[model samples]
Each structure stands twice: as structure tokens, then as C-alpha cells.
Target: MTQSATWDYIRGSDKDGYAIAIATNNTVYESREVDPATALGLTFRHAFSLSDNLLLRSSLSAVHDQTWSRRSDALIWRERLDYDIGPLRLFTSVDTKVTTLNERNIFALGSFLPYPESFVTLSVLPGVLYRLSFGEIGVSLTASRTMFRFETDYLGLRRNNDRVQPNLFASATFWGIKVEGSLSYARVTFPAGDFDNLQRLLYTAKATIPLELFRLPIEKLTLELSSGRTLEDTTLPFSVINVSTLSDARLVAKFNPSHALTVFARRKDDEYVGLGARAVTTSLGAEYAYTFDGGLTAIVAGSWRYTQETGNIPVSSLNLQLGLSKRIDFSRTTTADASRATPAAPTTTR
Candidate 1:
């Protein structure tokens, strides 16, 4: 069983902004069979708008027993800078002491995968983004160098022999809908020999239609359908679990019955992989929420899923959760408001 907790303290100034957070968690037995989770951690984020066109961000974190498979400690630090010109923006970042994954859990990486003990990797990315309101149109591209590491032996590879990869990606949005895509290619250099041609390409397109088509008495009922494919050197397009992430179609229906009541429902299914390949399961779920005029709100959510296994695997599970939360904004901080505060007058000495 593992549970985690996190708290964030954010403060911003006219020229710069800052946030501090801490988090930690504990995993009893740290088993892959079933997960009852608990942990606590905090993070601090800071952004500086040196000018209207220039911005910078930095953050750091520390945790214990946080990784899923490994037994260890972890720390992370990240920094990014961005600048905007006209309708285009350029961004780049450097990050270290973070754990992604080692290609074990094929499903959704960790839509629910356990934390392998805390591990860290150093990476750098530089990208550009553009958005034009002439008609709903947006474009984005990001390239990054990923250097993965392991505190212990991972994926049959030792710790010192880190893999290096250069990732390239681009995406765009159309109208109020989104049609974005990405491509990532890697070069794997092992101490043994060299593996050639390690690459992946991903594409996704989603469109949402207004409720005027269905004539439902609700705030919004969006008709959403999306499809994607990942092409790789070894993994066939949309066949392997690792290759076929987010390979599904989904529909969302939301209704605000009254000023204080809201409800939502959704259904999703996996796209067909191939003629003989195994297919992922499907799920249907619903949620109800109540909110008062105040800032407080309560939500209860649950889901029922059907699973299809290859052998004597568990067929499915009925999962449900109920949570209650109350929110109070101790400090309603803003950029403009904080900026308005008078800067300290230059001290004049006699």
C-alpha cells in the first residue's frame, strides 16, 4: 500500500514569481499485485517575467520510497526559459533527477503503474509554439535530448551505460478541435555492441462538437472522437502496448442539473490492433459533484471496467472512490496585482 501527500506554496512578484512545495510517500511491500498507496511531498515553482517577451521557471523536489519497483530515494530539479514574439513563442528547458520508465508496464506506462524506487535522469529540450486567432489555428514543435539513468540495474542494462536519444516532435490545432502529432527517434549505445534504428512516431486527432447537434438540456455535451498510431522500428503500428498508447475512442457527456449539482458520464474503448493481436479492455464510468456559491466543492467518482486477458488473468475490476475536499484561498496572488506594489525606493545615503 502506498499513499502520497504534496503541498505547494506560491508567491509571485512583478518581475519574478516563486513557489515552494514538498512531498513524500510510503509503499508497504511495494508489490505490483495490488496498490493501496500513501505518501507526502511538496514542490516549489518560480517564474520570472523579465519582460513581456521573456519568461523563466525553476523548481525542485525531494522524496523517499517514491519509486515503484526500486527501493531508494529521489530528488528532482527543473528549469525552463521561454520568450514570445508576435504569435510565436520559443521555449527550452533543462531537467535532472527524475524517473520516467524502463518500458516494463506496456499499458499506459502508469495510468496506474507502481512507482519503481526513485531514480533520476538529466534531459534538455528546446521547442517553439505558435498560435493565431485569425481562425482557430495553432502550431507547436519541441525537440529534446533525453539521457536516461538507473540507480540500479534496469532493463538488463547496467547503471553507467546510459542511453541517449534526441526527440523531435510537432503538432497543430484546428478550429476549436485539436489535431496534434509527435515523432521521437532514439540512438541506443550499449557497452556490448550497437543497436541501429530505434525510432517512434505518434499522431493524434480529436474534434469536439457542440451540444446544439444533440439538443440536450445541459451546459455542455461534447462529442469527442480521437485516433492515434505509433510506428517504430520493431513494434508494429498500433500493435504492441508500448507502441499503442491512447489508442481508443471516447465520448463525454456533462450536465449541470442545477446551480449546485453537476453530473458527467463517459465511455471508452481500445482501437483494434490487428487481426490476431490482443485488444485492450473497455470502461464506463460516471461522476456526481456538488458545489456551493462559496469556493468549496465536493465530488464523488466511480468506474466499472471489463478486462480481456490472454490466459488465466483476472477478467475485470469494479473500482469506486469517494472524496471530500474544501478549498480556501489563503493568498489570492496575481501578476498584475503583485506588480502594482511599489518597489522599494533607492536608499539615499548622506
Candidate 2:
């Protein structure tokens, strides 16, 4: 048996546009199969308005974990600067991270075994956005580099590997429809002479559409479709390149027949690629909720899913759930009362 506990604390200052968060997680194992572990994480973020047209923001995080025979530590930091001029905005950001893993125990049956490893990553992104009459369009370019090292006892040395990636992304929204796309290329090099260099390419695209029903109980409908593909090429002599494709699509509709009753339905499809294989899954789900006075609410949900894969038997499953919840409002003002008392913000004027 195992037990775990977690605690989180966050403090933010709206006047200064700064925030800090800290979290701790501890787990203990009772059985002989596993060991206990504890992890602590902290994050700090701040934003500064340099001028009426310029803004700067930065964030940093650190995490440390100690397990039976393994210890892990990581640190990440990012900074961004943005400047806006009329309908156009320009921004640039840099992110960097380092992670280290160490292991103390080497020989144990069914025990935690860790390999000493170190990883470092750095990324830079620059982008520009232009506001249109109806919506907005943005384009960004990213360059990233990562290095990984592993200590080997046999060679009494550490093996090094590195990868470099360059990516381009674009997004736009117009006429109640949103579209986003990205393309990335990566080159990986190994210095340990165990494997040859490799190259990989990835492409992804997504689109979202929202619809409103005027005369029906249905309030809104949202449809989303996305697809991605990855291609890999090896640098070894006479090595063949391989390509994998994945797709995901989902649709959701919401209905409110009465003030106290709400209903929703969703359909989703997902495709995953494996080694020379592909698997697909389709699911449909519906949920209904009813709220009564005295903070009582009841919900009923159902879902059905089907999965298919090459050279495997097709599988299907159905699930149904019922739940009830009670709300205890400790505040003197209710949500509706608060909304009525607070005035809306004024709109911007040109």
C-alpha cells in the first residue's frame, strides 16, 4: 500500500503584476515493493510595464525530488519582452532549463534503479502579430537546442548526445473560425559512437469552428479537428526513412432547456501511430445535470467507446455514471448578487 499528500500555496499581487507559488508532495510506501519519495517545487513570476507600449515578463521554477536511491533536480527560467505599435505587436522570448538525475542503488530486485543523467535545453522565440478588422493573425519562429548526457560504468565516462530544432508556427482567427499550424525540423547527433545521427520533421495543423443555435434548446456547438505527421531519417548508410501520421477530432454541443437543467454531448476520434502500426479510437458521451434549491445538484453521464487496431481484435466499452453534489456558500453575497453589484468595465475608444 502507498499513501501520498500534497500541498500548494500561491500569492499574487495585482498592483505589481507578480505572483509566487510553492508546492510540496510526499509519498510513502508500506509494502516492500517500493520506496518513499518526496518532491518540492517553487515558482516565481513577475511582469513589468516598461512604458505605455512596452512590457516585460519573466518566470522561474525549480524542483527537487528525493526517492529511495534516486535524486532529481531541475530548474527552468523564461523571459519575454513585448512592444505594441498601433495594430501590430512584436514579442521575443527565451527559455532555458537544466535537469539532473542521480542514482545510489545499483543492484536490487524489483527496486527503483536510476541512471545518472543530465539534460539541458535552451529555446528562443520571436513573433509578430497583426490585428485585422475581424480577428488577428500571428506568426512565430523558434530555435531550440538540447543536450543529454548519461554516465556509464563500463566505459567510466559519460556519453553525450545533442539535438537542434527549428520551428515555424502561424495562427489566425476570422469569421468565427480559428486555424493554427506549425512545422518543425530537428537534427540529433550522438558522440558515443553507439548510434548514427538522425533527422526528424514534424508538421501539425488544427482548426476550430463554433456555432450557435438560434431557435433550439441547444446553446452552442464547437467542432475541432487536428492532424499531425512525423517523419524520421537515419544517417546510417542505406537506412530507410519512416513516416507516421496521427489525427484527432472532436465535437461538443451544449443545451440549456431550463434555468436549472443543463445537458451536453460530445464525440471524439483519435488515431495513434505505433511501430509500423496504427490504432484508432472513437467515443461518444453525453451528460445531464440538474440543480435544485439549497445548493443541491445531480448529474448523470454516459459514454461509449470503440477501438480498432491492425492485427488486433476490435474492442468496445460503455460506461455510465451518476453523481450528486451539494454546495455550501459561505459568502454573504451570491454569484448573481455580486454580478449585479459590480459594474462592467468601460470599452476602449480609439
Candidate 3:
């Protein structure tokens, strides 16, 4: 069994804002397949308006996880500055991330995989956004560098590598559809020499469309599609290039034929490719919810998934769930109530 709890607080004024959040989770396992674990996380954020047209924001977060006899920790910090002109907005951000794993046992299929040692990454991003009639368009570029160090008694040696990545992204929305695209290039330098440098290129695109079917039983539908391709060129010692591609599509529909019941359906398909292997998966799910008096509701849901892979047999799975829930509103304040509760500022006649 697993249990978790989270709490958050926020304070804001005209020129400055602050927030803090913390979460703690514990998990217990009765079987031998898994080990008990406990984790805690804390985060803080602050924003300040440097001037009428300039704003600064920063955030810091840390997480600690303990499982069995092993422990892991991760920390991250980010800062951003935004400057706004009449019709254009410009922003820049910096991020630092660090992770350490102390001989942690990562279990997969009842087996232990290699435990990661530690890694640190630093990133800088600069972007510009322009408002349009239909929606908004934005372009951003990010440059990141990472150093990964791995050491284990099993390997009997320490290994270190460095990677640099630069990415460009653009996004826009028009005609009730949102589209985004990105291109990334990466170079990995091995401790051996420059001749062992690895180069990689990645391109990705995503789109979301929302529609209303007036004549059908469905009230609303949303469709999402995404695709990506990656190419990797190995070092001179290997002299090999590999290409991989991935595509995903999803659709969700909601229908309300009667006042007491609502129906929803979702479908998704995903396809992937690798050097010598390819796989495709499709999933279909449906749910029916019935509303009762006293804010009580009942839901029944089912899902089916099918997957096929090269040089492997196809697999299928089915799942079903039934649930009952009740709604509780602790705060009875409405917009009018809030407005009435706040005292208006005093005014003086000139």
C-alpha cells in the first residue's frame, strides 16, 4: 500500500509573489517483488516585478528518496527574467539540475539494473513571443551542457562523459488548433578523445485539435498527434549512423445523452522504430458515469490495449474498474461573497 500527502501555500502582492510546497510519500510492500520506500520533496518559488516592463522569477526544489538500504537525492534551481515591449515579449532563463544515487537498487522484472552514480546539467534559454490575431506565436532556443560521472565496484573503474545540446522550438495556434515543432542537436564527448565524439539530431512536431459535433450524440472531441525522429552518428571508431522514428495519436470524446448519465471514450495509437526493431501499440477505453442525488456519483470504466513488435509475438491486455465518489466543497465562498468580504480602499476628493 502507498500513501502520500501534499501541502502548498501562496502569497502575492502587486509587485512580488511567493510560494512554498512540500510532499511526503511512503510505500509498503508485502510481496518480495518490491521493497518499501519513502520519499520527501520540497519546492519554493518567488517572483518580483523589477519594473513596469521587467519581471524576475526563480524556483528551487529538492527531493530525497530512500528505498530499502539505498538512497537517492535530486536538486534543481531555475531563474528567469521577462521583459515586455508594446507588442512583443522577450524572456531568458537559466536552470541547474543535479542528481545523485548512492548504490540504489533499481529493480526491473525482479532483477536489479545498474545504479546510476551522479550527473549535473546547466541550461540557458532565450525566447521571444509575438501576439497574433488568431492566437500567439513563440520561438525559443535552449543550450544545455551536462557532465555525467559513473563509478561502481562492479566496473572497477570510474567513467566520465560530457554532453552539449542545443535546441530550437516554435509554437503557434490558429483555427482552433495548436501546433509546435522543435529541432535539437547534441554532441557527446567521450573521455577517450575527440575522435570518439557522438553526434545526434532530433526533430519533433505536435498538434492538438478540438471540435464540436452538433448533430451527433457527442458534445465535444479532442484530437492530439505527435511525431518525432532521431538520427545518431557514432564516432570515428564506430563509424555508424542510426535512425529512429516515433508517432502518436490520441482522440477523446464526451457525450451526454441524458441529464443523469455521461459517456466518454478515448483511443490512442503509438508507433516506434529502432535500429532493427519496430513496435506499434493501440488502446481503446470507455467510461460511463452516473450522477445521483446528494453529490454522489458512480463510474464504470474499461480499457483494451494491443501491442505488436518485430520478432516478437503480439500481446493484448484488458482492464476494468468500478468506482464510487462523492463531492465535498469545504469553502462556500463565491465570487460575490469574496467581493463583499473585501473592504474597498478609501478615496479622498481633490
| Collision count for each candidate, in order | 34, 0, 0
Candidate 3, residue 1: CA error in Å?
Answer: 10
- The global C-alpha lDDT for each of the candidates, from Candidate 1 onward, is 0.46, 0.58, 0.60
TM-score of each: 0.60, 0.55, 0.59
lDDT leader: 3
50-103, model 1: which lDDT tens digit per residue? 788998888786644323322334477888888888877788888777543322
Global Cα RMSD, each model = 10.1, 9.6, 9.7
Candidate 3 residue 246 Cα shift, in angstroms, is 6.5
Stronger candidate by TM-score (2 vs 3)? 3
Task: Tell me the tens digit of each residue's lDDT in model 2 across 250-345.
Answer: 564545422232233333332221224444666666555565655354555556668775566997766555545443322245678767753221
TM-score of 1: 0.60
**Total colliding residue pairs, candidate 2:** 0
On the 0 to 100 scale, the lDDT of residue 288 in model 1 is: 50
lDDT of 3 by residue, 58-137 (tens): 99999888775456788999999999897688999999989775532223332333554576768798888877665556
The candidates, ranked best first by lDDT, are 3, 2, 1
